[model samples]
Target: MPLMNWDSSLDVGVDKMNDEHQQILSLMNHIYDAREAGRSGPDVIALVDRLGQVTIDHFRDEEAYMEQIGYAGIASHKLIHKDLLDKFTGYASDIKGSGGQVPEKFLTFLKLWLTAHIRGIDMKYSPKADLLKAG
Candidate 1:
């Protein structure tokens, strides 16, 4: 099972946001491991649910930070967050309906989404914030 490693590059220069991101990554790894081990059921479903909740909470914190710092892309960032939440919610519902048997497709999707989203969208906001702090 491929694990999501927390790297400095994933940091958005916001301590709280970065910490939350780390937690999300950790939970993703846990879920991935459980899925790979064929341990599907309430255990996996509970992990997915927890990940979804953490994701929502992290997004909220990030949005609030964007507002505080007058981030120019706040609207687009929020849209991305909403889209992610929708996708996560759909995945959770599907797992619950399936009695917690998550398909391999879902695992692949989660890995790809987390990797790409953090590297792309999250990193985009980091430099500016870092610069602000440096100054």
Candidate 2:
């Protein structure tokens, strides 16, 4: 089974953002696959690092989109992003410091955060911004 699976319900009504989210989900699964396939520790760590970086890039893109659409909740949304980034930074540090084994809590947190943020927080912006919802 994949570490994480993207559901259509997680779509935030924005094509670009949804694509980014899918990429994030793919990267998450890549980490799991790497470990499952007995890839080297460094390889798994690299995947984790890439996932973190891609997440940061996605947040930047999402924030920019929010700005373009004049999203009223941008400030709060940015805070949420920052909080997640801070937590990711800490998790990355711990993973690397401990030789690349991802803690269970880290996976749990990522799963919960992505699901909640995409469905709850991300959903709020589109309707408020009057953007056309994508299928």
Candidate 3:
């Protein structure tokens, strides 16, 4: 089974951000599947590293979009992103140090954080934009 399934609830109402979230979800599943298949350490490590990069890119884009849309929480959102990235960096570093074998706890953290951040945190932005519409 996938580590995390994307539901409509995770939709942040921005197409680009939604797509990026999907990509992140997919990568999370890939890691889960790799573990199930008993994939090698180096391979899993590579995937983890790629996921990290993609996350960084996505966060940058998301933050920029938040700014452009005048999301009220942009400042706090940026801080949250930084804090999450720091946490993720620590987890990724641990996995790499252990030769790429991702632990169950990290996967658990991944699920919890992504779901909460997207639904609880990210869900805040879209409605604001909708409220501020020109039309």
Best by TM-score: 3
Clashes of 2: 0
Clashes of each: 0, 0, 0
lDDT (10s digit) by residue, model 3, range 1-135: 888889987877789999999999999999989988877588899888888999999999998998887778899999998998999999899998988878889889889989999978887787644553544
What is the lDDT for 4 in model 1?
69
**lDDT of candidate 3 vs native?**
0.87
**RMSD (Cα, Å) of model 3:** 3.1
User: Global lDDT for candidate 1?
Assistant: 0.83
Point out the higher-scoring one by lDDT: 2 or 3: 3
Each prediction's whole-model lDDT (CA): 0.83, 0.84, 0.87
Once superposed on the true structure, which residue ranges of model 3 sit more than 4 Å away at CA? 128-135
Candidates, ranked, lDDT: 3, 2, 1
Which of the predicted structures, 1 or 2, would earn the higher lDDT when compared with the native? 2
Error of 1 at 88 (Å): 1.1
TM-score of 2: 0.88
- Give lDDT: candidate 3, residue 45: 92
